[model samples]
Structures are given as structure tokens and as C-alpha cells.
Target: MALPEDMLHFVWKYRLYCTQGLHTDSGKSVVVLETGIHNHDAGPDFVAARIRIDGTEWVGNVEIHVNSSDWNKHGHQYDRAYNNVVLHVVYEHDGVITRQDGTVPETLELKSLIPVHVLSRYEELMRGLHWIPCERLIRTVPTLNRSQWLSRLLIERFEHRVTAIFDLLTRQRGNWEETCYIWLARSFGFKVNAQAFEQLARSLPQVVLGKYKGRAMAIEALFFGQAGMLENVVFNDTYPRELQREYRYLRKLHGLSPMDVSAWKYMRTRPGNFPTLRIAQFAALCLRSTRLFSAIIDTEAVNALKNWFEDLPIASYWYEHYRFDGVARPHSVQLGKRSIDMLLINTIAGILFAYGKYIGNETYIYRAITLLENLKAEDNAIIRRFSALGVQAGQAAESQALLQMKTYYCDKRKCLDCGMGLQLIKKQ
Candidate 1:
């Protein structure tokens, strides 16, 4: 917020600088022919700009700063890319500035040119405290503007997910399948026992799972054993004892250590969301899925893919019990539409988006967004609060974007960088 250079960039981009009275530090009149397209990439701030300084048309680049000396502070004086700069724009002309070739570029001091009200409004937006800095004014922003900003937010969230998945991929030595399995397991656990599920997934290697994936019973044993849920339990049921026996054999064969059962939290959690059942469901999915990531990528429609997962059979034991000795769930233990949507949104669709980014394919990205757009908006505190503010999400796409905006932008008081803040600040 303290960087007047950002405000200067905005001013220069929009020609908000006082056109009627503009001059360089050397008392030469100035006129901007075109601000040029702002360079969002590394090189210059603005490229191919047409500016007239002292009756000379210089078509090149533009660089801005709070003071003239920042050209050297940022090592732009040593960079060849700055050699073509036509004008050095600054808020205060503290010192004379030069290009890499040692020629002084024409300097435009923006301090007296920008409207005071604009800067004041920007400062106020940056300093405010509320659910969001612009909560009071956000609803007033034009719909088209909000739509464009939400698209950017969605892309931001996509990039964040892609980066994280890449990190997981790297940790597994560039194994995409293992990363997908681990990520899927974490998503299956949701917010309650995500870490424990992830630990279980990591502890059991893909090779061992591949060896037993054809058998649902063995898959369940591997998952439950690594989760540390089958330790020292004397069960009267034949199936539970079979799982304990299978786990004992697999634990010895794989040379694997079980995770602490204490790590799996069940306090106040729903019976349907119990770790025991979730692992069983997860094992079922792994048993049926071959090339799970590719299948998700190739699957075009949401419901078709959803039905594929819904077809996974919940083991009979899960139907009879929520835990090793728990009472039976009266209802079938099949994953509901809500649970499926959560997995699709947080895992399957998310992986598609990440894979699309990794492979530089727009098809997968389009599929991911379409799936999200078709789903119901997630019913959560964030989505509800956004709805109360008159910024309702029509689908999961907007809700996901809103969640990102609230977490990474609003909560951090980054209103100065938000579109809503920009719109309100520039309002007359």
C-alpha cells in the first residue's frame, strides 16, 4: 500500500494523470500517445508505449517508481531491456536517472498530476477492517466487472492447486499416479482426518496396492492396517478377524509400520464420515480404478463420472457397522451426491485442472471448469456469507473463486490488489 509506484502505474495506464497540465522534471511538456499494454510478465512495466516528451515522439517502454533513483536500485540501469525506455515516470524526482547505456530518459513526475481523491480512496480501502474491505461497496460494482474479477480468482485458485500438486508430484519422484492417490485419499478424509489419510496413503507404496487392488478385501486390509485401525482387536465377527489376519500378513510382507490410531480423529464427527468407512470406500475406489487420473481426464461429463464412482460397492461389513464393533447404520453406506460432489470438486476435478496445466492442454481445463459450473454451489459459511452480501454464487465455480478471494485476498486485507477495491476507489 505504501508503494505509490502501483498507483502511478494505474494512473499512467488509465491516463488519469492531469492531461491539461503535465511536464517533465526539466520543464518540458509531455503527452502520452498510448500507455502501451501493461507488461504482466518480467521485462518492462509497459512496452511499445508512444509518448511525446519536449515535442519528440519516443515509441518504446515506460518504467515508474516512487523516486527517480529506483531505476538503479532495481538494477534496471544494468539491464539492457531498459535501454529503450522513452520516459522515466516517478512520484518524486529525487535524482536524475539514466538508461543502461547512460543516457537520461525524459522524466515525468506524477505527484502533482494524479487526482488526490483517487489516492485517498485507495488508502482508505487498504486501511479498512471488515469481512472484506469493500463489503459495503462491493455490491455496487457492475456485474460484468465482478464476473471478470471472479474469473481471475478462479485462475488464481487453479494455479495454486497446480503448484501444490506439482510439489506432491516432485516428492514422489515425479510419479503422477502416486500423487493422485495421495491427493485423492486426502480429499476422501475431507477436513476432519485429511492428514491421517494422507499418511496412510504415503506409508503404503503404490506397488503393494497395485499387487492387491484386484481384491477388495486385501485392499481394505492394506488401508485399514496402515491406518493403524486393526491393532490388537479381538473381534467375534469372521470378516473383522479376516481383515486382522490379512493385515498381519501384509504388514510383515511390506515391512510397513502402522500409523498411530490416535491420529484418526472421530470426535463429534458424523457416523457416515467415520474414518473406518471412508477407508473402506477409498479401498473400493482403488480396487475398481485403473489409471484413475487418466480416466478422470478422459471423462467428459460430471454425472457419468459421478455414476462411475457411485457404482463402487461399499463392503458388507461397512453396511453392518460404522466401526470395528459399532452399531449398524440403518441406511446404506453408499456415498451420497454431496460426498461425491465434494470429491469431484476437491479431488477429481482438481486433478484434471492440475493435469491440464501440467500438460498445457485447454481441453482438461475446460472440462474441469464445466464440471464445476454444472455442480451446486458448495453450502458453506464462506458461500453463505458471500450470498448475504448480495454476491451470490450461481454454481461451484463462483463459490470456489469466492473462497479463494476471501482466504487469500480479503482476509489478508489485500483490497488494494482486488478488483472490487479498485472499482470502489475509482468511483466518482
Candidate 2:
């Protein structure tokens, strides 16, 4: 059976192929020196490779293919970029590849050199249908290996999340505080109303709300009004009615347009997690902090950071009601520790890491990782599933990594690319 081209790259990268009497298709003795850096970008499979072809030290790129004909099929023969390719490594050498300048590159056939077990193992992983490709074999991998993989995954997750933050920052003209505010607002919506909350934030910039820094009522009015939650609703209660009046004045003054009220979701949502309650809590946060991003950066302790999101001094009306015009019923409007941790994991860490990368400060990046390490692991379906499979995440850091692994690697079945998958397949 034919194997994936990536398997050939993996075999070459790890030197899993046998080296006894290795020779190119043209009968030139091949001695492997450095395998070179694996290129993820365009141009070559591996770059800066140091290979001695029959006592001729050639230091250049190496291209891998399942069949040698793929080079011409991929049009690298016509491209001038492939002229620097020192060696063409392929599983099967069928056709001769010549560069545009009539210089035929040396080719190494890996079919016989690669161990049969390695190919079998890779095939098994590719064909297996399990929770993960190596679900049954995962326990064989050492805890140290798993931890190392998770650490890499954590960084991957952070980088992936930071890409979005950087894009938003660019749109915000590199305003970190504005980006933080918008990101935090999205996190407050949890998953259900995240887009809606982001829309509200984009509609009303943080600087506009910054004007009413210390005033809780004014901030709530602007948030609720811009969210379109306060429109076309008659309230028997005094607070929402007052919010409506305040928002009308603020809306006209700021010349702002409110998002459609339909954007906010309430069905199947808990009372505390309702968009109304979250908006109130978010407004309270705005009322409490002036420079939110700076506060996040300056705070050292995890508890101190948690305090920013916990027990926000929201309007008294929110404590009694989850929505506008609702009757008073005592409920905890305060964010639970878990909710606070979610915000820390999703919102705070990302912003910190993105800022670190933006300003080229490793301190914020270190601080971001440290914050996740200090927090407890989140209890979600993804974390729970990994825990059930004997991979327990002890901290938010590990959980975050596991979440990323599950989504990007496991779900996509990119087993050959995963560390755990690599380890499991390599095991005898």
C-alpha cells in the first residue's frame, strides 16, 4: 500500500531509515550529515541540508515526494526555485528530475532503506478510527512526553488565539486597551453570545464609555442601550426605565447606533449567564477599571487579577433581575470562581501574550503562561474526555493545551504531526 508523503518526511527527519550501504539512484554513495530545518513554508521540504553525495559535500535543500514524478507533476522542474535542491528524496524513484538548466539533481530512494515496521505503524495510525489515532496506545507514552506535547500545544493555542487579537489590534490601529476591552466583552458572552457582545463593543468604542468611568449607571445605560436591549420595552421597574432615559440621551450625544436586540441570546442560557446579566457585569467592570489592559499587565498575583472579574459592583437592579422589566428575585450576580477562571484563560492570557508579542516583551508572555499554571483546570466536555482517557489535566494550562490538541490535531486526524501520535507510533 502507498503511504502518505508526510510519512516519508517523518522517516527522513528522524533518520528512521536504515543507513547501511545507502546510495542514490545514480549509484553515488550517500552519507547523511545534518537533516536541515524542516521548512513549513513554500519552496522546499527541508532547507540547508548537509549531505555528502559520493565525497561531494552538498549543502542545500531536499524535497520529498511519494513518487519522483511528483516533482514534474508539481511543476518544480520548470520553477527556478528547485534548482537549489541538493537531493530529491522519494519513497519510489520512477522518473528522473532535471532542472531548467539541464542539471539533473541527485535522487535518494527511501523505499528499501525505511524499516517495514515504521511504514506499518504509520499506516495503522492513518487507518485507525478511534477517539484519537493512538487512543489505545496513548498510555504507553511516558507522562513526560505527554507533558512536553501539552506545553507545545499550549503555545500553539496561544499563538492561534493571538493571531485574532493581532488582527483586531491592527483594525483598532494598534490600540491594546481597545483590543482588550473588545476581547473581554466577547469572553463575557462565553460561547453563546460572543459575536453579539463583540458587535456591541465594536459599535461603542471603549473611549466613548471611558468618559463615564466611575459612573456605574451611565456605563450600564450605554452598554444596554448600544446592545439594543433597552429599546421598545416598557418597564414597571424604575431601574431599566431610568436606563432607557439615560441611554436615549447618551445615544443622541454620542451619535451611536444600537445593534438589533435580536442579536442577544437568552434561551437555554442560565439566569446568571444571560446576556443581560453579563452586560451588567461587564459594565460594572468598566465602571471599576479605567485602563483595563494596563491593570491586567500591572497585576502580579492571580487572585488580584481574578478580583477584577469577580464580584463586580453591578447595578442593584441586576441582582434582583436577569433582564429589563423583570421582577426582583434575589440571585448571585457575582461571577463564580469558575467563570472568573474562564475569563482568565480565554481573555486575559491571550491579551497578555499578544501584547508581549506586539511589544516584544517576554515578561508578559511569561506572565501569561504563569497565570494559566496558577489556575485550576477547567471542567468542560473536552477536558473531561481527555481525563476519561487517562490524560488528566492538572491546571488550566494543560486543559487549554488538551482543548487545542483535541480540536486541531485529534479532530482533524493529523496524527503524524502530533507529538503523542509520533511517540505512540514509534513505540515497538
Which candidate has the top score in TM-score? 2
Tens digits of per-residue lDDT for model 1, 260-319: 899998998988899998998888888887457766766788878898679676688778
lDDT of 2 by residue, 1-428 (tens): 66678877888898888877889999999998989899988988999999999999989999999999999899998888889999999999998889867799999998888777777777777775787777777777899999999999999999999999999999999888899989999998999999999999899888898898788778989999999988888888888888999999999999999999999898899888999888988888888986799899999899899888877888887777887777667989988888999999999999999999988999999999999999999998878877878889899999999999889998888887899988876676
Score candidate 2 by TM-score against the native.
Answer: 0.94
Quality of model 1 by C-alpha lDDT: 0.84
What's the true lDDT of residue 128 in model 2? 54
RMSD of each: 3.3, 2.0
